[model samples]
Target: MAVVVALGAFLMTLFGGWVAQRVIDRRHLVLGLAGGLMLGVVGLDLLPEALSAAGDDLFGVPEALLLFVGGFLFAHAVERLLAVRRAAHGAADWGAEPGGPAKGKERVPQVGLTAAAAMVGHSLMDGIALGAAFQVGGGMGATVALAVITHDFADGFNTYTITSLYGNDRRKALGMLVADALAPLVGAASTLLFTLPEELLGGYLGFFGGVLLYLAAAEILPEAHHDHPALSTLLCTVAGVGFIWCVVGISGG
Candidate 1:
């Protein structure tokens, strides 16, 4: 199961990253589309399960709380680490000089690092969702994968673009590409370790859900709204939700 998941995630990451490169240059369309898809993932996949988890006694409430917290802390830590790493890298690159030689200096990618870290965390959470889905039923597990892949694809598309915009170097872009590619495999490999305390897992899940929600509302959606009219941007937003609605309806997810 782990190997299959690893391979699947890697392949998906590669595909998503590569396709992202093509659309990175398309700013408005990409942001709009990315925003919508993100909303869909949250509404169609994560929310339903999280809401259901609230009612299911076998999973336990404490466990659910832990999952949210764990995921949130993990994401927060990764973001902080990446931010620190970026600052250090920049300071080092500057080397106490005015307009130091930059071309050969190899300006490293802070955003790419964050993107890779974020996605790995994302994939690990998805792996849990996948495992949890199977606990319910085979059909539900497959359904979760379908929804997750949709999310992952959009995630790859946007991260690749955002990282590329920050990096401004094909080599840096490639690093983002490869790093994004590995995140899911890392997540898949960690599946064996899911036996940690239930509350712990619950905290992570809830926290991660919050991370996704915050990202969608605070970061991704606002970016989409900037300089664009609210209503026009909203149409795309609804379109994204509508697309997911259609997918869920068709797939019975």
Candidate 2:
């Protein structure tokens, strides 16, 4: 049953990616909406759930919160390391120019791919959660499925947008989108073999939430406004957040 429901998620994800592909010309709006959706998922959905599930506190800080901070720092560090490496390689290849390599352009594709990979992992977990919920009861399963299906559009959209925004080729973006689309099904099937611990799940969610937040705040949102700087782009972002909020509220109710 879980697997069957996951099929819906798959289709929705593909549809979302298709939408992103269609809007390539309006890159700013696509990015704005994606950024807003990421912010909403991290703040309104993932963090709250992580806090609820991982109830352990260490030195007056929730373990999930600690992991969240760690994930953010880790993402930042990885991007910087990749940037430095690219800079060095470019200098070696092109003969040490006065200004060095174009760090901004060179490092973007890596970051996009990394961020898209994280989204894939998140989708995998979503499927696992869907399957686990069904194990408990159909009611629980349906509710979880609803949440997963709803947000997965955003997932698909972001996966494609992020991959392409950073200068990755269309084929690579589509590949990531397909992977994202399939993740939930794979995750749901895995649940038949074993269940994940709630604490572990919480920790993972918290960490991923942080990674996503950093992408939205530090990468996606800035990129959205960098060229366009239009009111419509900002509104699209707000609409994205509102859309997620509504999804969460509905799921909770």
lDDT (Cα, tens digit) per residue for candidate 1, span 125-224 = 6666655554444544554555455556655655565565445567765666666656655665566565544433334445546666555665556655
Candidate 2 lDDT by residue in tens digits, 1-253: 9999999999989988998768645867877887777777678777787787788999999999999998888767765754522322242344446564564345567877887887798789778877876764564466557557766876787788678766789999999999999999999999889765888878766776776677677766776786689999999889978877887787672
- TM-score against truth, every candidate: 0.61, 0.63
lDDT of 1: 0.57
What's the C-alpha lDDT at position 44 in model 1?
74
List the global CA lDDT of all models: 0.57, 0.76
Candidate 2 overall lDDT versus native: 0.76
Best by lDDT: 2
C-alpha RMSD by candidate, in order: 6.5, 6.5
Task: Tell me the deviation in Å of residue 86 in model 1.
Answer: 10
Identify the leading candidate in terms of TM-score: 2
Model 2: which ten-residue window has the lowest total lDDT?
Answer: 84-93
